[model samples]
Target chain A: MRKTVLVVEDEFLIAMDLKLLLERHGWWVLGPAASVEEALALMDEELPAVAILDVTLRDGTVSLVAEALRAEDIPFVVASAYDKPEHVGGEILAGAPNVGKPTDQRLLLAALEQAIYRMNGTSLPLDP
Target chain B: MNLEDLYRLMRNGHVQAQGIIDTVPEPLLVLDQNLCVQTASRSFFSTFKVDRDETIGQHLYELGDRQWDIPELRLLLEDVIPKSKAVVDYEVEHDFPGLGRRTMLVSAHRLFHPDNISRSLLLSIVDATKRREHEAEKDVLLGELRHRMRNLLALVQAMARQTTAAGRSGEEYRDAFLGRFNALVQAHDVAFSHNGAADLQQVVERTVAPYSGSPAGVIVEPGPTVPLASGQIMSLSLILHELATNAIKYGALSVATGQVRLRWEIEEASAPRLRLVWQESGGPPVAAPASSGFGTQLIEFAAKRELGGRVELNYAPAGLMVEIVAPLASVS
Candidate 1:
């Protein structure tokens, strides 16, 4: 089975581009949700192997989804234009790579691959 | 660069730097480690007009006693140089070389190597002729601001005393001038707190803080600290206090029957801002004043000029409303 990825973003253009890039790489794409609450609901039904979270969502913070991911044993990466990774906590930054705002398509895929491998308890190509 | 080599080059460079001194505009002099004059710029030479051939190896104290050649300067330079700290300092004097009797701001610095060691002393002199004149102008302007505002207060007091001189009770002049005077005093006080700059909120709080009793039913709450320039603070404080005083006198807190409400906001969120509003309700209907006076002129035009805002007066059935939408600013 192909690896599954969730892209949670508020901006329509950035989310569209991310979804298109992941699909081209032969991965299954889940909902490109715009809000933290929407992403949480989507995950309740289908647990994607990895998720890309924008730190700031329309109504609230993506930390809620991060908490859920921790409980469910799923890995997630944070991509944001405004917030620094340190603000979320050092440990969160340790588990995830900070793919800063305006990320390249190739770099986003690389982060997703590393996240998936780490979640499955396989040896990381490089320790996160 | 290697530290010792850099120091050797710098020490030799100052010894060779005499050729460059003549071209500098300011009076510059290079002093050796022993505090002996090693080089003097052309400006410095023409300024003091001492015989150059005779003065090169001569001690600086060999020059006659005057404003330019003082022992205090040598002591100051010697004291700060050993610490390897660079200093740009000021000194005011009645007269100087070529620049005749005027205030001069002297700056001294010790030349140091990249290794953080003192090499030689470099002293630069600037003619502070224009700067003194500018400072004088500022002093005059601040003096005028104080005088005009004080006169305005006295004028309000005179008007009050004259208006109620007839058969009215003590409450009449108290009604006419007390609120306006309270506003004026509060505005001045607020200016001091803001370091002579004030905004709408500063003025409001200063005026209302005194009589702001829970039983009196007028609660004054100040929002975030916004800095107002000295001039604006004065006018804005007076206006807000005047308004509050009136509300307490006859409009809101005067009668045992009602209370007053005052609050302000920054309406235009984009560029320079505007004062949102000061809405006073739950009071008796505000009747138009029988005559427009200085208070009206200040609220309508003077305060507008001070704050650069447009004033809106609403005589609603419930209470009086004065909303000023002006270019927003904390400090000038």
Candidate 2:
């Protein structure tokens, strides 16, 4: 199955930018969700191989959503301008990966793949 | 008395007759029919700081050694003072003692002491330096007030921005943002107090102090002291403001146990550059943001364009860490 990535973002331009970047990198981009409710709904309907979460969404922290994905065994990476982790809670992401804001395409892709491998122990095809 | 009698008595110095002219505070002088400065009042000698005895025998031209004198004084007293029928005053550069040279108002009144033949002129002079000095001081004060007002306005604008941004976050976020904004404006005021030459260490220390007190338990320690240019100082201050705001709402400072380590050092490799590291730990696992916001955009803009620097923001398991590198020459 083709690997899918979920992109949750509020800004229209940022969402489009990420979507295009992911597509150019050959990963199937699921969505550029603008709000927490929308991202949560999408998470229920679709199961992405890697979820890229922006800590501060339009309405809520993606931390809860990341927790839900953790329960479901779906891996996600957090990205924010905030200099601290666990924005939603102080739950040290045991093996989770984080990406900083305005991140370069290569760095973001690395974080995504790393989170994916950590969640499933290399179940998906590895892209070195 | 008749014209002849008036002249005889005036020249002879009758005590009551000379009292009126000599008692006047105005520096009054008497010119004989030839306009020769003759037998002037005591005021004439004292007011001009003249050797009273030396000038007693001289003509108008030979009065007190005038610094800025007009040879036309006799003409003015003879022609203008009589025809005008009123006190006639004109500006002259007076040569006076103790006061080297000055602008003065010389007024002359043509009078005949109860007799037409005895022609005498009463001349008075007043100094005008104090007025000019007062006006100059007023202009300087106005300029200083204008500068202070502009700085105050900038501070108010920053406060407004902080409030609106914090309003988007929770109470904890609001307090943190407010605290940071206050620090920025306060630092600006202090810097401007010394005309924008504030010590760089004082500015940075205040900038990072608030973050150390956040709910996230972040610890901010200032690095080695270095001087920064005024513009660079302001840019760095804003950068810290934006970073602190973000950390309070969504980063390490937001959590109760998150910790942040801030340190800066001067690198003396090929070029002298300053490197700063912001490390966050004891917080939740880190990840890339789903979307970049204004805070993210500002970081890049200030670091790159304003400060001419490079920044790397990494989302790590321990938390989010940031690295900033800028040239040392940018200090203004």
Candidate 3:
């Protein structure tokens, strides 16, 4: 089965743009859910192979969602305007992969792929 | 008078003076000409956390490891007090023992007694520590607010660049970008009016009020008031503005007799949620557009991403109806 990815971002244009970009990459997208609650709702119905989350939302931070994803053994990357990990959560999110907002599409994809492989205990294939 | 009688009188006078100092509410002190502490009020001992043995008969600077050794304070006591015969409202900020940094207003006056030749000074202190800290905190909050505003402007700048890059004509790009910017402004206005938390009804009313045409033109059935955070308010305002702009240009609001009804309700579930409806009627026949435009995409994306809700836009023959269902916490 093709890998599925969940996207949780609050910015409307950014979310739409990311959705289109991810879809073009041959991954089934679960959601571009805006808030933590909505992201959790999507997770309850089905767990995506990987996820992308914004650090801040309308209601609160997405640390809870990140914690939940961690608990489920699902890999996820932070895509947010906040550059420093301390702004999100210092030690708790220290090792997780992240892509800053106004992000380069290529960088985001690379991070997502890295997270997936890291979770699966594998390494990316060397370029021919 | 005999020397014994003079000694008895001086002792009695000192006892009476100590009694008066103990009754003062403000932190007060009685000091001799040499700036040695003769007495301190009960308030002074508790406020500065100094004990009786640590203060009385000691040089002021020697008390509490020289916490009172402030250079400015020394000037006021040794220089200003003597030349002026009194120092009023002398301000000093210092790190006192046990207490952190404190701002204090010190006032002193030379005491006079007809029967005595020596000079004693009465000093009073007003602690402004809490007030200063509160002001400092307000400054920090204001700075953070400014930083957020600058970031918002930067986001707008990026959006403008992207919109132009998407191959829009000059007029089309200007109109679309300005519409979005104004929507953001409306959101900020509402958020600021309510101190960063705006009521949902108020936000809706503010967005559509301009297009209402007349008093009954847009019927806003009051709904349960929901407090939305600054970010939520901005996103909702953008969505509503987009919908209203569409209504006026192509939907129900185009005609004079057109009407738009707005209302919302709380969905009591495992977690409470908000359900809003925007229904329009008495206008041109409606049909779904051939393709989704930027406006439509914004509404759908915001409802899904910003509010954690579902958006359903039905273009019926009669008019257009939009339903939004999202978690209350997300929207508010």
Candidate 4:
């Protein structure tokens, strides 16, 4: 079975690119949600095995979404445009593995694999 | 001692006390129980553009064309100061005759003499206008800089990831990325230069400039002035760039007789909308692509997702036509 991953981003091009990138890596991609309300709504419907989040969204900062993910004990990675993750989301995102914007495909995939491994104690195979 | 004796003592010490107050730098005033100015420092006269002759012994509220007659100040001196003994840093904003508008932090200290009947208040004024203005200006500048930098980086990253490298050589991929990067740079310049919004015509002209040299080149019809927000301008510029690139590669601009005409209008309805039309004519027979490419997806995403709009791409034997309709609120 393919691993499921939630992708949260606001920018249309970036979101679409992420959807394609994750799909290419053999992961079942959930919504590239545009806002906090949308992200929470998606989670209400179905929870992904892991999640990737942008620190800022169209509606506001991703703190509420981060807290919700933490409450569910779901592992996630930060893919932010900000230089410092703590600056925008405060302590809620203090230690998350951040794959900064204009992401290196290698670094992003590596971070996601690490996050999933840390959570489940097993790593899922991805397409080279 | 009687009130007369108190007045004699004050008169005797007036010059020496005035000298000491003058050296204090900031504006200072001594007001009697009646709120009448008993004496003022030299700095007070210079700061307020007032002279000692007309200021001393005058009612505090009645000085400088009655500029000092502020309700907040009245409340502080008449009610608050008397009860509190000292009112520190009471903010008062008022328009003075020569100084225009200024924010002042007024501190008043009640001085009780040995004689219970005689009382005076020490008032000091510190201008806080420049400090407050500077703080507000710095905050706006920093926020704008951070937002612009992050957005620019994200845009470049998206282009890098999406630019297809499947069949093309390294140079081809670099050119494609640089082409989109240039469009983003120009869009950013146009958006920020006009204070977070750009003219629609300017965006169109700049995006299509490189492809305009082709025969029967691109013609932009004059339309009503439309201003788009920074985000809208960036998205629209990228969409135009993709369209122009496609046209030059295989569509209208590839042939000498081919031409492209761009026009737009504001559709009036319950909610006004902007309708932009890009029509290519006199090119080789047109047909829809075998499969959707990166350009096609970019144009679709930029229109439908970013602008919250609808896009219609029509492939006709004569030419290709693309129409985009977005809410006026979203674009502006």
Model 1 per-residue lDDT tens digits across residues B61-126: 564344446555665666755665565655645555555776555576677667756577787766
Cα lDDT computed for each candidate against the true fold: 0.65, 0.67, 0.81, 0.89
* DockQ, 0 to 1 scale, candidate 2: 0.01
* Candidate 3 CAPRI level: incorrect
Fnat across every predicted model, in order: 0.00, 0.00, 0.18, 0.62
Give a tens-digit lDDT track for model 4, residues B113-193: 886769999999988899889989998789668865876687788789889999999999999899989998998899889
Q: Give TM-scores for every candidate, taking all chains together and pairing residue i with residue i.
A: 0.38, 0.50, 0.58, 0.69
* Consecutive 10-residue window with the lowest summed lDDT within model 4 chain B: B143-152
Using DockQ, rank the candidates from best to worst. Answer: 4, 3, 2, 1
For A33-115, candidate 2 gives per-residue lDDT tens digits of 76668777887888889888766666766666777777778888766554454644347343456675555567888888887
- By lDDT, the better pick of 2 and 3 is 3
Candidate ordering by lDDT (highest first): 4, 3, 2, 1
When just chain B is superposed on the true chain B, each candidate scores a TM-score of: 0.49, 0.63, 0.59, 0.60
Docking class of 2: incorrect
Off by over 4 Å in 4: B1-147
- Identify the CAPRI category of the predicted complex in candidate 4: acceptable
Model 3 regions more than 4 Å off: A1-5, A10-17, A24-27, A33-50, A56-61, A64-76, A81-83, A95-98, A101-128, B1-147, B150-167, B197-201, B213-232, B253-284, B301-311, B323-332
Clashing pairs in 1: B22-B42, B196-B230, B197-B229, B198-B228, B227-B330, B273-B328
What TM-score would chain A of each candidate receive against the reference chain A? 0.85, 0.86, 0.89, 0.95
